[model samples]
Target: MVVDVVKRCFRVFKKANESTGKILGNMIKVQELRRLWGICHMDWVTGLPPGSDKSYNACLVIVDRFSKTQIFFPCCKDDTAMDTAPLIWNRVVSWTGIFTNLISERDPTFN
Candidate 1:
């Protein structure tokens, strides 16, 4: 019963997918990322209770794409892009050195 339902739904979806491709014509291809030390990814972990001594409720996580190494910096929830950029530059980059590319989740404030 489930298999039959799935096949029916898949047929409908496949027809729509084919028609959309015909209407859209060409599709875009994204360049693949190479395993290179030049690439790095960053993200924020938020919505946590304050820590022991300081009132840190969030963390800025930076990961090296090649090395798979991570550096986590504890931060307050109120830190803005201005504060983060400098902190990453002065502290994180100073230690880990610089990278060619930085991939982020495009967080509203992080932009």
Candidate 2:
């Protein structure tokens, strides 16, 4: 019957697709978490025109890896390490004290 032929063809197609879909490579190794506030990740988000504060066009987001606590700091688009250093000092370092590791994506602002 036509239905039987269609089902057979569909099974063959599915088997072929499944074989082609598998990845033949090693997987990425994940880093081990050691302690609270040990690793802090930082990143900047931009593209907002400006807020009511007028001075800030972006935000700096910091996350503690172990605790998963986050802090958001309002920042200008042009702010560099010189500007962000004090903000990190006042907002994060003051509260968490010194941490062992800091992780961030390659961003010019963090440099």
Candidate 3:
């Protein structure tokens, strides 16, 4: 019964023909589209240095979609937002000349 209900909902959703492309088509520019496509699916991996102190082993990763450029910085676990912010801004902003959107996992230490 649950499966049938789910199937019916899926059919209705598929038939809806939602057209987001039309809405987004005009506003986005070619450069903007290229930038979006460049960074749309980039992944970064950062972790502690080998046997580094747990209190200060966070990593910084910056990815630029347009150029597929990346930079990595290793920081201490005890670093605060105030400390990390400037380091990130300098390295990432200087390299990309634009502030890349950051998607860092919430650090409990920041609390």
Candidate 4:
């Protein structure tokens, strides 16, 4: 009888926990496009076969979220954050101006 009572209490607690853990009305807020190149989607394509010059084994892909414009910058596979930031700052930022938002794959280069 003691075991049965404990089992019933455990079942009640499990049900209560299950009900309390659920989220009902939370929704993800979508970003709205406000200007050209306002939101930049950035990613790196690594492990690519060496190009004809053999200097580049990776590419930094930057896409404009608003206009769907894409830019590919050839880069080395082992480039660190220092090497990447300057390339984007000089090449991409110079061309498109400053962007408000940047979406990335959270690679080490962005760190």
Candidate 5:
């Protein structure tokens, strides 16, 4: 009885909230015609067992969004932005040059 009443009240409250909600605008999609070089996506893989090098337990993976080519850089778990930036510059950027767009999952390190 009480549980049923509470559920009914909750449903009414939810419906009221939904009715008052604002509609969001449609999202814009990227078109390939606007594609340019140096647009890439990056991600980090961590928590792997230490390798033969012992220090490098994580990998920084960068992918060219247009070409679908990937580059992997071995890095230590404690690598700072200062430490990792040069690796990207020397190993990845040296070949592809500076990137205009870099997409990645929200990560504190990238900030």
Candidate 6:
């Protein structure tokens, strides 16, 4: 019996780029966009294998509308409102200083 020593990489997901035209279509006034960019949008990502407790991890998405820049944060699953609240506040404040608004979607775990 002959064994092959080569290892193959797996394609776990599909990839596609958002077109420039699509980005241009979403544009707003530059100044207002700058103000909006100061705010952050956060959401928790869940849903994984039933037996995999590690799926409890949270994801924080920060978007700057003006620059169209985005940053992501991966946090622990066991984090609570008290814990997460401060963490999110500190992170955004540090990056953008005083932001006028913050947007967050309801996460099932926090309930």
Best by lDDT: 4
Q: Worst 10-residue stretch by lDDT in candidate 4? A: 21-30
Clash count per candidate: 0, 0, 5, 0, 0, 1
The Cα RMSD in angstroms, rounded to one decimal, for candidate 5 relative to the true structure is: 6.9
How would the candidate models be sorted by lDDT, starting from the highest?
A: 4, 2, 1, 5, 6, 3
- The collision pairs in model 3 are 55-77, 55-78, 56-76, 56-77, 57-77
For model 3 the local lDDT of residue 33 reads 34
| TM-score computed on alpha carbons, candidate 2 | 0.68
Model 2 weakest lDDT span, ten residues long: 21-30
Clashing pairs in 5: none
lDDT of 4 at 69: 96
Q: What does candidate 5's lDDT look like per residue over 26-96, in tens digits?
A: 86454452344457888889998898978889999998878788888888777777887889888887878
Misplaced by over 4 Å in model 6 are: 1-36, 48-56, 109-111
Poorest lDDT segment (10 consecutive residues) of candidate 3: 36-45
Tens-place lDDT digits, model 3, residues 14-60: 87976656453444322353343234222224465644555545555
- lDDT of candidate 2 over 1-111, digit per residue (tens): 999999999999998878656576875453678887778888889987898968889989999889899989889889888998899888889888887877777688765
lDDT of 5 at 54: 87
Cα lDDT tens digits for candidate 6, 1-111: 123322211222222333446343453333344564565556665443333555445566667655667777666666677877777678767767766555565565467
RMSD of each: 7.0, 5.2, 9.3, 6.8, 6.9, 14.2
lDDT of each: 0.80, 0.84, 0.56, 0.89, 0.79, 0.58
Residue-level lDDT tens digits of model 1 in 1-111 = 999999999999998877444354465443455654467888889998899977899998888777788889999878899988998899776776676787787787765
